[model samples]
Target chain A: MSRAALLVLADGRFPAGGHAHSGGAEPAVAEGRIRDADSLAAFCRGRLHTAGFTAAALVAAAPHGLDPLALDEAADARTPSPALRATARKLGRQMMRAARATWPGPDLDALARARPRGAHQPVVLGLTARSAGLGPEDAAHCVAYETVSGPATAVVRLLSLDPFHATAVLARLAPELDRVAEQAAEAARQQIDALPAASAPLLDITAEAHAAWPVRLFAS
Target chain B: MSVHARARLRAEPDGRGSTALPVLESAGPLALRRTRSPRPPYARVTVVGAMSAPLNGDRLAIEAEVAAGARLTVDAAAATVALPGPRPDADPSTYTVNLTVGEGAALHWLPEQLVSAHGSRLHQTTRVQLAATARLLLREEQILGRHGEPTGALTTRLTVHRAGRPLLDQQLTYGPDAPAGWDGPAVLAGHRAVGQLLLADPSFEDAPLPARLLGPTAALTPLAGPAVLVTAVAADARLLRGILDDAMRELLDGLKA
Candidate 1:
């Protein structure tokens, strides 16, 4: 079960449409905020600390045997940007489709149907993890890994970095991964009802600007 | 009331008289309320209840206590145009607004577009205080001049504080007199109009935005740490519309990120 779950969650082709997003790496690159492998790694680390931490914690804290539909609503209420919300729902819908094909559960189906016009990805992920009988700590680890790995992997694809070097970046992020998972576990235990929130205006501004560009590599 | 110096009106509310909320004299607790219909293609807003306020001669100092669930859509009867102060005045006309939202409360402060006429100088500041569970949505638009007219000089400072810590701090200075200031590639890029929209919620993770939404005319750059900064130039009204559309889409896209 552990091996299968890892394979499914870590696979780059999970159909979440994450491949289409550089996690802000493209604009960061265009603006010269990330130039080389080291800078890219550094950027991933920052994301892990901020947005990544919040997401992992929320996943870990999913109520025991919680309803997936409730989780999706929680996540939707938490998100503010219309574009980001759409992207999350797209990703969530894709991930749900893939997970259902592999795991196949009544809960997953019910959760998908319950989502509002637009549901967020993280909420669906947490529901999937819980339904699979995964522990909170493991669920937290998966969330953190995907949050950091999405961008790190995107950077490699965008910059054409060596595959081996990209693996090394992941290796270096292990400690951070552990730390974030541990923190998420603690937050889950506390069972805080609030969503993980960060006030990032510039990101919203850039994402808006990026959407209007005539040409782009990622879906945002 | 001591008439120490002449007061220049930076921006007057849509009506002729003062708003229903009384303007206070001292720094004690104050209340302010504002309501307006939604301008087309935007959301409606209404601000009600007690707020903090103080009087400074002809100028009014205002602070707002935004209760939980209160909504405010700031609209103008017309574009807010800043005119130059009378002669012998060194300080520019200014307005300072401070807002606070209680736990579980939501505040949407969407104001109409701003137009700065030539020879007009104005300084404006807006600060918001958010509780742990508070939600805030704010939008602002600034146009430098009417078509065919040279852009005027304008200075603006915006700060947001959450749970007693500063979350966002931004300052912009422009106009012909500040030649080196407005022309900088990072500042205005010679654009006559600019807009900003901010929404902060503590319950969700930061959404991931696509790179294509940022326009080519402006530079959409990320700052140190977690913040991202986007700046661009708009040569005319059409360009400004494009910029606003892109910005609004992105701000609402937070759900997908």
Candidate 2:
């Protein structure tokens, strides 16, 4: 697998439709839970270990050449919120579309056919990693970074928080992010049932509330 | 001491809900009761204390089954306070629930508040299986401690399956002494009390979801399994309950058929 594949998959600007979602910072921001750059960092950190960690593990598991259908189910069971589930599948559909155009493979085509609506994003991400000839660890890193980066970037727009401070927060979290991605890849090697189920209740809760917002920057 | 309670419900020939008398053991720490809602098509089973017994080292199991086309609702008569056993470090008490909702049936399990007392521990697991056509509206809430003191330990695991498809499978374990569990933002970010409501139906995906959850203290997550999972947390009990009830009302508003 080319190292560049990871950069492509991990890049935020990729047409994955991640730009519309806040990773659940909007409600917290609206409620005054996230006041500034520092609080934004704190929110991202919490999401990293919980949902980020879980997404990393799920993404890692997808490239294992295992049953993608079962992985999809595992993702569904692990995800407690319907809104997040819809976002995952929607992002997954977009990823499938983009990944097929860029990487073109039977695995991607079959998944698209089976889940015409879309599979969970992490599952699609892992399979996309496979299409790109990337390994489980590479996929894990992609999701682990995505779990936080989506919000770190969103809060800058939502709160007009300092972009440099947000980037610094991600920079400071680099070490922990590496640790989580590594741990997630290891967990993915276990039975699909054994994959991490760690979640941020606040994220789920906020995503649900955010989905109802008539006027919002993000789709989630 | 060990205690067990069982309730079974089935639809009658006239399409009304009927249930056998609840089965309970008199020599245990828990008692069971069944009641009519004073309204048609609604029934409730309540779990109450049989006697003043120490909850430490106690095991209580509640089992309920809803037959095809029937419905049943389970509720706790009052808040259950878990008291420490002779040894504070002893194993926590356990409350296990096993429920099955048959084809075209529904079950509403709304347990009251569960408070984990200082020096006390509680572990509860609720496993529910629903037929593809069945529906479930489940709500769970807990307070970290009785007064201001920190709770000893509390763990909750819930899983729901539709036909052979798994809808939700997750667990949460918390203790005040454990700095790693709740100190992180995802678990609570520092709040003690937590509440969750899950409404899963085959028609859920196309169904209209609540415009907003009850308060600022909570948020909801959407599941790919055609279900909506709502969660909230707060340091105060009243606030947490209010948040949960608000979420619950939204989920049940137009969905109940």
Candidate 3:
């Protein structure tokens, strides 16, 4: 359990193809729902507690020697929007590629063969964490942080707000982020059925709308 | 006061090839009535509330099954409201619905909106199981609060399984005690109404609908299985239904094609 491994996996430059997504920020920006730091904080907070929380639980549950395939199905069940599902799998495949290159394990090989298309990103991240010798809480923190970091970074590029303010937004959310990760990890210890199924209907709706956009800055 | 209610219904093909309700039992506050069906071979049933139900600590359950080759439609007469009980410290009311559609059978569940009134708490769960060849259409709508009122705590979970495989499972929370920022821009964005329509047909396996937006806030997307989900949110229930109705019309037309 190297703490440095946690830092590496949590890095925004991990090449997981997350750079292509705005985490629903693109559409919110188009709708003027997210204008500056204050609105961005609200949006990020909502996403972190709902979609982000669910994903972190999956990330935490992915290890523990659980079946990745079943976790993938659970991920599918948790994700109602088809566009977001596709985006998750695409990101999953990219993450798998990066993880295998860095860790090189048979577990990754077996999962890749099982899901030729790709598993869910959080599940893949969990497996990547296992191969990296990181714990479940570590995996949970990675996703919980990524959940807000991706949006904050995207907003910086999308709105051209002060980068300092954007970073400050993440800094302010640190306490809530820790709380979400802890709860997610705790829930992951239970039966998969008992895991959190929190959702954001507006996010699901907007992601579909974003996918259908004739012109857009993000893939979803 | 708290009450426990149960309703069970079974729709099957009759000797005349029309759908028959061989079993229809209503108890407590849940009243089930068979209504005339404009389309032959499809039995339609409407649920009428006999009293103000789902009060705090109440447990209500409805179970419906569609036998093979049968078609059924279940609807409600009016919006169901959640209100607090007499006690100052009351438990949240619970409503559980279980539905099953057999092979080659069809079930349409189009219940009215569920309104969460002030100072009430409700937890509703709906689960549906479909045979590999079954077709289903289900709709769920939630209005946070009545006119000029703040909302109570409300949580709803919808889970669907097709041929013993998970299709969709999601839980939504609103009002007090929900996660922080639920009404923020990323979740409801201050909207008071939210709803979704799920349509699953074997035909979708061969020809899936292309994902697209139906309105400013609603979009239709194909599920991994042979299903399509349309989600929408609006300032009020009427606008929410309008968006869903339009999407439903277009999707039903697609099924016909």
Q: What would the per-residue lDDT of candidate 1 be over residues A42-119, giving only the tens digit for each residue?
A: 667655654566667667766344445545544443333345557778888887887777767776777777763435
**Whole-model lDDT values for every prediction:** 0.57, 0.76, 0.91
The Cα error of candidate 2 at residue B165, in Å, is 1.4
| Tens-place lDDT digits, model 2, residues A7-111 | 987888898888988888777778777787767777777788777887898889878777899989988898877778888999999999999988988988999
DockQ of 3: 0.82
Number of the top-ranking candidate, with DockQ as the measure: 3
What is the docking quality class of candidate 1?
Answer: incorrect
True contacts kept of each: 0.03, 0.50, 0.83
User: Which lDDT tens digits does candidate 3 get at residues A34-137?
Assistant: 99999999999999999999999999997777788988998998887888999999999999999999987988999999998899999999999999999888
Q: TM-scores, in order shown? A: 0.52, 0.81, 0.97
DockQ of each: 0.03, 0.37, 0.82
TM-score of 1: 0.52
Docking class of 3: high
